[model samples]
Target chain A: MGKLKLAVGVAGALAVGVASLSALAAENIRIGLIEPLSGPIAAIGSEALDNFNHAADRVNARGGVLGGRKLEIIGLDNAMKAEKTTEQLKKAVDMGLSYVIQGVGSNHALNIIKFLDKHNKRNPGKEIVFLNHSAVTTAFTNELCSFWHFRFDANVDMKVAALVTQISRDPGVEKLYLLNQNYAYGKSFQAAANKLLKERATDVELVGDELIVPFGKVLDFTPYIAKIKASGADTVLTGNWGPDLHRFVKGAVDSGLGATFYTVYGGIPSSIGGYGDAGKKVNLKQVTEMHENQDGLPEDLRDYMKSYIEAYESTWYPDRYRWLIEQLAAAIDAAGTADPIPVAGKLEGMTFPGPLGEVKMRADDHQMQMPLVVSTLTSDVPKHLIYKGKDFGIGFKTDGVVERADTTLPTSCQMDRPG
Target chain B: MEVFAFSLFNGILYGMLLFMLASGLTLIFSMMGVLNFAHASFFMLGAYLAYQISAYVGFWPGLVVAPLIVGVIGAAVERWGLRPVHKFGHVAELLFTFGLAFVIEEVVQLIWGKVPMPYDIPASMNFAAFSWQGLDYSAYRLFMLVISVAIFAALFLFIAKTRIGLIIQAALTQPNIVSALGHDVPRIFMWTFGFGCALAGLAGVIGGNVLGTEPAMAITLGPIVFVVIVIGGLGSLWGALVAALFIGIVDNLAISYDLSFYPLFAVFGVERDVTGIMQDLVRLTTASIAPVLPYFLLVLILIVRPRGLFGTRDV
Candidate 1:
């Protein structure tokens, strides 16, 4: 009789211990970050991840979300491959992480959305939500849209619309040349530029529209530069990223091609070094969300930038990931649960204050509407703290900013929502 | 006419650089029946080492010291890495070098982040060397041309005239006989491999800034080096030279022109509502197809002459 009583007491104690451990686990929410942590573009992923972690720290410091439940980020290296990304997504699901963030490649984004849709259909109550901080392909929020996928960054059409507005304002750009990589993103960029140029800047002649090289294949761009010079193009508009952008700018400088490079990715690190002193002499412009030394930025953003630079030793770009997490936290709080379906529903058409100003996640499409800033690289240094170019060891000075009101383009998305 | 002249000049300069890289690989492959797949990786190492060294002691000293450092690394790789793999045969040796290439790239990324290093032309050489038809040619490119030509002449004399060169030549033909003559054949092999890598290092020292020294530099230039060797008649130095120049010039000329197939189709009087894959083919231009020219040439050459243009033996 005494032995039976002791056994009952031990069993009751074990049940209590398990229940308390689970409650402790429930106090924290895990968000998975799938990115290329290793490979050729690891630096890009590392910087983005650093920004994500910094954003998480800031959120947690501000008492987190859903009444102080701390947020934890789980990063998995997908190596920028689709197969590896799917595998990591599965792992994230198995770990009970309902929210996953991915950026970088649109191909990977499209694959993840398809994978998630299929997985959610099979698993019912275990549906996962995908938050895209970058990868601006239109199809993600357009024809290929999913109920579970939400993109925080502007799509290609929106960026093109903003870029065209900037280009039209400059009367010096009479002849424009379009050079881009031959891929989905590049094709979209070309198509949008063509349509937008015709609509907005009809006076500007399209001198050359060439998609001559594959991504990351062209080492020498002298031939291309020669063509541009021969065409007498006053402005060269390109959407090429990575080494392609750097090499093209370098070739232009080397060949003395006297054209303003109005590019989407001209401000990335090491690109300024490619221009050398030529950048100071040439017209180099880029479209971004935020830059250092903007006169009227909010105090909170300034403080955030200071802390981020102090920790990472690099300047932080206005990443949508920060705003996405804040918005996600607010949505979770509104829903009063960590379950993805309800939280995702709450996230639709959500409005939150971002670094630049107020940002809204469109209900029609899951695309975020935020401000775009058009800036130029000048010889002058910024008055405020800034991220210096790693290669050139010089800070980028901005010339202008286009507010969200002026840059946001109307979305053509007709989303098919999940009942 | 100006564009044609400029393209030709640029092509010749580019070809000479390719020759400098390929000459070493051809000699190494002939000497030790092992194709060093990591040859371009050593080239990349040379560039990165030069960049680091240049930060402390100016560019001129970096040029000298960096190649020597690469040579030592190459010799060590031969003694420790390649020598052991030789017993397992050529495939094992090739795979070993292939894996070494990846390891070197990862190490480069770890030491220097993935961004392109600020390996620019020295300030003194930044000005234009000359002007042709109102176009300014960079002084540094001219300097690169002179260095490549000088190295070629020096390498030619060293291999054709020196006593060590004669021994190396003999060993290429009869390794066992040369070893029997009180010569340490393995040490000679190690020295030859190191010398070959040093040549590649020299190419990198010059080519790095022009080509942009990043982690992907090895993979970018690796295949072209192999193509040069194969087309030049794998074991022959002169053959490699001719092939490299040919490829470089042809590639440049192809890129310089933008001839569309649509015009060709019109000339042939085959004008119909082109659709599907046919339409895509019709829209193709010379500039779009230029990157593949060298590979196309390689295939054609292989089919026509399996031994290559100047090859004395089968590759």
Candidate 2:
């Protein structure tokens, strides 16, 4: 009789445990962050993860999303390879995850879009939505637009337009030169620069244009700088990032070639390490979403940036991520279901508050329309910024903010909506 | 005319830097008969050590202290790691040094992480020393050129004039005879290997100041150093200098040219089309293929003269 009573009590306890476990699982929404978490670019992946986690925390702290259900971000390492990305996507699907976020490489982005298009068609009611945070290829939305994909960052054309606006305003930029990495993105950049300059700043003369291999190939850029100097180009525009950009700028400074450099990736504080004082006279300008050292930044946003810098020790993260999460939560709440199909429908043509005011996702192309800021790397900031245990004594100052309407570009995205 | 002069100037400066790195490899390969694959890693290690020491003390002390540390580590490797493997054969020594290179790079990455350290030119030497045709040559570069020449002269005098240098030269060819002279032949060999590594470390101290001091830098410079020694000939120190300068000038001139293969093909009456790989090759520019020009010169030399110019004998 004692054994029977003991067995019965144990079974009852086990039944209660099983019931709560199911309830707990149902109360959480898992979004897969498929990115390179282990490889050369792992630091970038983990930094993006931390930012996303903080965004989720902020959303959850605000009474949770979808009637108090928690948001869970599950990282799946792709090792920065395309094949591994496809495998991670399959794992996410098999695990019943409906949404995955990836943005480091456009190759991986294209892989996810093509994989999901077939997978969704083969198996109805199991659709996955791709939320892109930073892959900025213009053709992704314009030519290969997908109904299931939503991009939060501005594309190349919009960025070029913003830079050209600043160029037209500057009387010093009379002779323009274009130097870019010889690849698809670089070719697009050259095209965009030429097209936009013709349209916006026709007075600026293009004196020299050249393309070179990306990185690891060019050990010294002095020869190239000499050519630029010989061309008598007073202003130079380049789409080079990483070593290519920094080394060229360093060579220019060492050569004392006093031409202004308008670049794509010079705004990042970490990339321009040890180059602050040297780069001061070069008139380095970059186009981006926002800068910390604006003339009249709002107190709340300033406090927010201060807190983030205190946590991360560097300001290399893009601000569009926080905006991405806040907008996502709003879309989920409005849809009243965590299913990606209905949630994506709600996300299209959505508008929410951002650091720079109203941010929108255009229904035609699923591209986010937001205000872009053109900033110059300078020692003379309106406000001094200290970060990473060193008094930087330098910050990116706001040249001006291109309004959202001005940032919006026309798209050719024709989509097939679901029934 | 100005472009040509400027490019030539830049080429000579680059060639001298290459010689700074290639001289160490030449000593090891020619004197020791042991291909030290981890040579560039020693250079990398020297740069990293300098950066660390410079953070504590000033740059000047680190410049001395870092190379000493690197030399000590290299000597220990000769005593413990390479000496045992040396009896196995030349292939074993090659494989051992190759493995050592990988180990050093991994250890560097483990400690330093992936981001580049702020190892930059010292502010005291960061001014334009001269200007020609409105283009300034930096003081730091002048310092580099002086150091390279000084190193070349010192190495040349030490090997050609010093008593120990004579003994070393004798030991390489007459190891048994020198061993009979009541001297420690093994110890001399160990020190010679260490000295070769120290030269690389010294090169790293200056090279990292301008090029960069990262894990990938060793790999980037490793192949070019081998090119210098091979083209210089198997055992010629002077040959290394001449070959390095040749490659450097040719590389710079190649990069300065914007001319394409179009003109060459048009002269041959081969009209370019858009469809084929041959057509694309025809459209390729000289500046785009400048990185491969060194190897092209190497192959051309090997085909015409396998022994190499000024080299006493082939390896």
Candidate 3:
């Protein structure tokens, strides 16, 4: 009887330990959000946070993920700097967040990718997955494609390619001046456009091209605008967004060059609201249609975006950026599990119904190669007009778009595969 | 001729604005021997204040009230923030101001958030200022030029004529002697700092309409202000003026030209790519020069003539 009692005690203790472990492990999905919250890009960062949190709340309201498992979001501010991103990403790993939804910028994303790959290789069993919402460089999804990494934004090449193809047909644009932000993404856009222009439009005259400093200094545009006007170029194509564009445009107009036509990238909410009228008056051809915004898709598929936008007035409400986050979340859901390794595998050729339209993350490069919407700015609208202008009829070339099959993953990224 | 004329006109107009920000910076540094990194932040604050004020009271009242408030704030900063850090040396003072800049930026964001304010040109200045060469120039920009020049003239007269100005100039020239003369040297320093800040605040008010009142405006404008000061040298108002104009002209000219021109390598049959490596090179070279030109010029001038153009002494 004594031996039997001892045996029963040992069994009970094992059962209690198992019960505790099970309770500890019970359905908690932690998704990490890395953005530049405290730095110069904090505005954009805060917006991203608002967007992600809103989506997370919506997802949680609909019974969480994977059958009643509560989804939790962990936010880490990388200050939009590369070194800081690496440090914060390590902190996320330490916090035991297996999945991450990151912000824009290639350098920051690259840093996280390096850390995740190394950590996963070393630990083997505990894999961390990174779902990128901000970094638009093709490398995250291309040759440097990690099984643990997935990208949501359309790459630099695709965005510029779509705009350039449509702009090339304009007869008035005999000569063009190119101004871009000086960085990897900017350089890539310039490079990609050059390649496409060479392959296609031979008549386009290359006038003065220049790159602005990254996180550019406040500059007087008299000289630059004068140069553009003097170059006798009919049109200008620039790859700068936000405050820089605002300053540049005002300065350009001030310098007596308002008549000179130009195209700028990275449309923001404020600019859209205020200058949408100006853009329409000047007939700015902006790219808006092809992303993951719900309005860009069919009626049945747009309910997710429509609901989110209706609830959140200014954040994800029919915007390009909100669509990006939604697509990323949907991709995680499509994999049936938010584990980066399996989810990243399922990301390829995944058709996610986003706020913009139906987007497919290509299997080859892992970039979402959706149709690019060419919009013109109109002065009459309350919001910055994307498609209304004198040249409204010539929308972005939806047909000439490079299919996902044409884009190869970047050749530069060489990573060791996981066993 | 039309393009050159237009560019020159643009260069001068831009130069005047640069002078407004740069002159204030140069004066403060001349008076205190401390590069106020927070100067641009004050300018940004001025813009925000004007935006808020103009919404309630008209633009002209905002113009007056913003600078006065900024001046008072600057005086407070000098008394509390910079004075404590001054004993630690100039570098420490600069670092303190840098920290102040960081804080001010965050505070601005906290107050205004990240969105750009709708601070449009006033109805009075909305029409064309003047037109030449088939181009319609904005009245607001013209107004900016007029106001900047007026401020410059007023500043010149004040420094040349007033008793406080004389003391400040003496401090810039001979701090020890000025102290020996019993001018309450620290008080003069405080007033000068406040005055410089007021000028920057005024610039911000006018600038906000042209450059949209946004939190990040300071960061974008900060380095260029420094560039203007450094190129102007540390303690000379005149040098600052010349450097600012030079920068304005060079920046405008650089962006207006083709990027394929290598002063050294014109021999290579450089094929221009509209969107490729060459295109990117052009864009980078032309666009980045304005912000860095003053720095480059400063370094070159230091190497050739250490005191900067028309400067009294080495920084």
All candidates' TM-scores? 0.93, 0.89, 0.86
**Model 3: per-residue Cα lDDT over A1-419, one tens digit each:** 99999999999999999998676546577777888787666766766777777666766777765556666667788887888788887787788777777856778788888888788888865788777775777666657777667666666666666667666766666887887776787777677777766765678878766677655464555555656666776677776777666666765555456443434353446554333223333435555434332133566435554465556544232243445445545656778775666666666677765433456766655556555555444334323212111111112212233334333233344444455
Candidates, ranked, lDDT:
2, 1, 3
Model 2 CA RMSD to the hidden true structure, in angstroms: 3.8
Q: Tell me the deviation in Å of residue A31 in model 3.
A: 1.4
What value does the lDDT take at residue A398 in candidate 1?
A: 55
Candidate 3 docking band? acceptable
**In DockQ, how does model 2 score against the reference complex?**
0.45
Ten contiguous residues minimizing lDDT sum, candidate 1 chain B: B128-137
* Candidate 2 residue-wise lDDT, A307-413, digit = tens: 67777666634778877888789989999888899899999999976667788999999999988888887878764444345555667877778888777888988
Runs in model 2 with CA error above 4 Å? A1-28, A36-41, A78-96, A111-127, A274-277, A295-300, A382-387, A416-419, B87-91, B160-163, B166-186, B234-236, B267-283, B298-315
TM-score of chain A of 2: 0.90
TM-score of chain A in every predicted structure: 0.91, 0.90, 0.80
lDDT score, candidate 2:
0.81
Backbone clashes in model 1, listed as residue pairs? A371-A404
What would the per-residue lDDT of candidate 1 be over residues A1-419, giving only the tens digit for each residue?
A: 99999999999999999999778655789999999999867777777788888898998998887667888888889988889999999899899889999988998888889999898988988889999988899888777888889999888877877777788888788999999887789889999999999988888899999885665467578677877877889899988876678777766777677788888878766566555555556678888777765667778788988888788777767557778888888898899888899999999999977656788898887888887766777656654223333424344555455567765666667666666
